[model samples]
Target: MRSAADRETAPAQGAAGWYEAADEPELVEHGAVTGLAVTGQGEPGGAAYNESAGALYAVMGALGAPMVPLEGRWWVEDARSPFEVPREEWRWHLFLRLPDGTATIDAARAEVCSGLPAAARVQHVSYTDGRCVQVLHLGPYSDEPASLARMESLMKAEGLVPHGLHHEVYLSDPREEDPAKMRTILRQPVR
Candidate 1:
């Protein structure tokens, strides 16, 4: 919605939406994330989504993850690997949070591809291959059903299965409210 500088210089808006976990590129934190393989079947909706734009930084701090701020357009794929847009949607994305210039996507590989063995509490992370639909959702998560529908339609038309389940790149922090105008990106991974 605004320029990179605007996203930064401009004081934290009342609330923000979601984007790719990688939309905000930054160095990795010094820990891990404790999460499971989240999935969202049905319409283009979301779950356990954050709603505070400014709180994102604090959330990252608590989660021990890293991220950068970005602004762009994106789409939503399906359980299969397909696209809602023709070319790669010019949406916002943050590089995976890694150990200072290391890498963040390894989580997806280890967690999704290999499947974490399960150990102690840490920053439960995940990774996805290049190319993912980044859907910029405006409104409450309940409205996400329609969005998911849109993504499913795109997948069916393109013959792409959203086999990777669902992942929400939380761009806002719920503690702050303003849900009605909140922003979030429901990322449906494609094969």
Candidate 2:
């Protein structure tokens, strides 16, 4: 028999694994997750992205859910490599995971519409990345290409092909943390 307190502190089913990745490239399978999300097209750290993020945080804070790390799914419209595409052209869905049994979307929407009009664009969304290749990326965001290249090499060696958007779980706040000490989980869904 487990105590209620113990159950309360336990991670939700599959939640613990979702945010973890090895320093070296490896395969992982993520279960379906539900959360609040807002989509936009802009370079990370640009005005549009920052505004959207602020809105998301405001709504989440209003809901009183425990803060979770921010996550992003990114892609580009151009056929060229995402790296080659202009930063301003990047499309992204920013996500904040809601705790299990959190308030309904209607309530969240109402909260948004009432005082946080900017968050009106936020929506309740769910997704399953399924099988993926992920690795822990350390240092500044600019150095992520090397980590991504390593993940790509592992994927190729394992006969995997990318099947979903490029994903990142931000484990450090760039505004407060040292760029050299930033940690991010880079994930790529694959088939």
At residue 58, candidate 1 shows an lDDT of 38
lDDT of 2 by residue, 1-191 (tens): 23323322213238777778889887777878989999999999999999889888888887888888999999999999989999999999999998766657777667767776778898888888888888999989889999999988877776679999999999888564587779999999888
Model 2 misplaced stretches (Cα beyond 4 Å): 1-13
Prediction RMSDs, each to the true structure: 13.2, 7.9
RMSD score of candidate 2 (Å): 7.9
Taking the tens digit of each residue's C-alpha lDDT, what string does model 1 give over 69-157?
42212334534333444233212222223333334333333442222222111232444333334356666665766776776564554
lDDT of 1 at 116: 27
What TM-score, to 2 decimals, does candidate 2 have? 0.89
- Runs in model 1 lying further than 4 Å from the true structure: 1-96, 99-120, 124-126
Worst ten-residue run, lDDT, model 2? Answer: 4-13
lDDT of model number 1 = 0.37
